[model samples]
Target: MVNGFMGRVLRAVGMAVRAVHVGGIMAGYALLFGAAEARRLLGPRRAGHGARAGGLHDGDRWVKMLTRLGPSYIKIGQLVSTRRDLLPPAVTGPLSRLTDAAPPPSRRRVRQAVLAAYAGTRWPFREFTWEPVACGSIATVHEAVTLDGRRVAVKVRRPGIQWVMERDFALTLAMMRALGAVPKLRKMPFKVMHEQVGSAILRQLDFPAEAAALAELRTNLAGLGNVRIPEPLADLCTPEVVVMEYIIGLRRFAPGDLDAGTRRQVVQAVLAAVYEMLFIDGVVHCDLHPGNLYFDERAGLVMLDAGFVIRLPDEVRRSFADFFIHMAMGDGWTCAQIVIESAAHVADDCDVAGFRAGLTELVQEASGAKSGQFALAPFAGRLFDLQRRFGLFPAPEFAFPLLSLLVIEGMIKDFDSAVDFQAEAVPVLRRRNMLRDRTAQLHK
Candidate 1:
């Protein structure tokens, strides 16, 4: 009884200390950014000095604070970067660049974790490297060769990471709750957002779940012909460790690195695969950032990391498909109606008429814009802003599907600026029967 009491006291004290430390850093940065914005607004305007320049500066500081707070903050930042509606372009722009690289734990710790995961069975690997090939917040991957001489990647969870992340999330929840006392912040659903993110992060600790996702995605994308998903070794996968086929020669490439024809082929394949996931399969991969995506001449488009996948409900999938289809056909009223009908929450005092009018104008402007004139990032920002203005909140389901596309938009544009993004979706929409006769007439 005494020992248990002591443990509880220690845990409480630790949490308190963490709260102070985290709160101090956050408050400091908030003040710094506030002052910077004030100065920018009051100072004389110079050539090339404007909100964009100031925003970039503030973005750098925000990145530094997140990095300093460690893995949990970094992961949250990466997730928040996708919500273009919540933040400005300058901020989300830098947050999107946040990488998950961290130094690997000691080799001894990794070996112990691997052994603990396979306690009852004989080791499957004939050769295993003690050193990690890559290290991220939750796990580190090492190269290994199976008894049958097939090479694979073995991912081992970091020791004690789950407890650490749980503690961090608890602190984050507390901080968010305190922030919620503010009237403006209270309406934003920050608590709900944190809970969703916390749940996703916790689920990522389950290697078996990720392994299952990899298998499901591989099967779903098989018809695409140009995408590759690593095959998880089922017999070797455990809650704490996963073994998968190791792909080679996967590297980042620029638009100039590939021939024009190859670029078109790769971009089209990627778009088709993403649309299939969002519309047909309903299994969307949310983390398609550059680090998780690579190009191989032979493999085509190689996608890695299935830890952040989300399965959308059939209704949500159909709603998103309808929204895109209507948007493509220049039917702004239909697009606005789709958003309202699919919204997760609408304030009691929501300005429905204003929202409808604003969204109609927004969608029509986007649809009529010429190639190279419309961009998804800015459009998403505006869409979210409009929602915020009218107190309408889109379903969480909308964010991940859009995130999948936003993460790859820059790369797609770089590869082929003239590519018609809206038109590309017609094939999938038609396949799903989402393109009604109205769409048929427009396409014709």
Candidate 2:
């Protein structure tokens, strides 16, 4: 057995060496071809048939590339999609296509993972069907019945995921380092943003930690009837596996498959929950994509994947409240102040006047504009360019707002094409401010 294991290791090392040699040769040839292609197509060469066939800026190309590279690269695109502040709309906008879910591992692997997570459980596998109900890069989920016949969703981490993830991350980081050293990327925030996103993804892949976060969120949102978090089944829970209350019904509203009215309600509920998290609860589920949220038509809102929650400091939360108010009242000065404060860490050397001028212009322009009339896609693109064109304010943390702002606003517009963002938001801002004042009075 020892000799056989050693032989396998030696064989594996030989395979790795051969693979690297072939890969390097391929890469060199590809680079030569690519450089020649670029020189011919983009260089001083005559504007040839190349320009015609270049056709559309199909981001789906990148999506397919990531898929072929495997899970880590796929997640990198999703992470990139969120950072509109760091990337131009041209790059970040196309990342939205990266939401295709990962292929599921076999049901046998899922059961083994579950059993491994709960080391002492000799419980028969009969308790849960081996069929995977949902699957993704980090884990797959299966609906199960307990010995007592309780319906629950069993989430099991993919086999050997940790090692593969670690290897992929190391490779990605090395690639980022190389890319950062590139002349074009040296001035951009993509490298820093890449690291931050990698960190976020790492935290999310830790299933035990996610289970704990789920526990806290469920507790915090306990009394809210409109929002629901699945209760973790403690007895069946483990670092690599989590069991939660199964939500069976769905179909009210999601990005796809919703009437305007239903979509609007879903949008409102989602944003309001975000409001509650930032202001009232101080915690937010950061990954707010459609897959992370569901409309349980019979019950209400159901949020999944508690792994990527972000907790804001009190001062930050207050700034949020202030932004909301100023946005509502069209108060440029206050809005500018909040923008400065919110972004102080990023643009330390920024001309406050210029910063305020830019934000104020946007706020005023968007203030009373009818919803569908104003396209924020270009606005997002403009901001990305502003950062690149001007060395003014470079902060990595600012990426979240870049992500949240467009996401929330776009969701509103997507749901109610006729509903102006400023119009809908102003009323909520007024009510929240009023509530704040009354509550403050009671406290005093």
Q: Report lDDT (CA) for all predictions.
A: 0.81, 0.63
lDDT: which candidate is best?
A: 1
Candidate 2 per-residue lDDT, tens place, 315-393, comes to 6666766776666566767776765555533433446676666767766766556656655566556655554544343
TM-score of each candidate structure, all chains considered together? 0.83, 0.73
In model 1, the runs with Cα more than 4 Å from the true position are 1-11, 24-65, 76-100, 297-299, 434-444
In Å, residue 68's CA in model 1 sits off its true spot by 3.5
Model 2 lDDT-worst window of ten: 49-58
Clashing pairs in 2: none
| Candidate 1 global lDDT | 0.81
Instruction: Give every collision pair in model 1.
Output: none
Model 1, 1-444: lDDT tens per residue?
A: 999999999889988887787789988888878887777776556434444446235666777888767668777667566545446777877776664455568989999999888898998999999898877667888999999999999988889888777778888788789888988856666687778767777777888899999999999999988889999999989889989999988777456567889888878888899999998899988777665777775848888888888888888888998899899888878988888998877888889899999989999998998876778888888999999899888877677788888877776777787778898899999988854566688988
Cα RMSD, each candidate: 5.5, 6.8
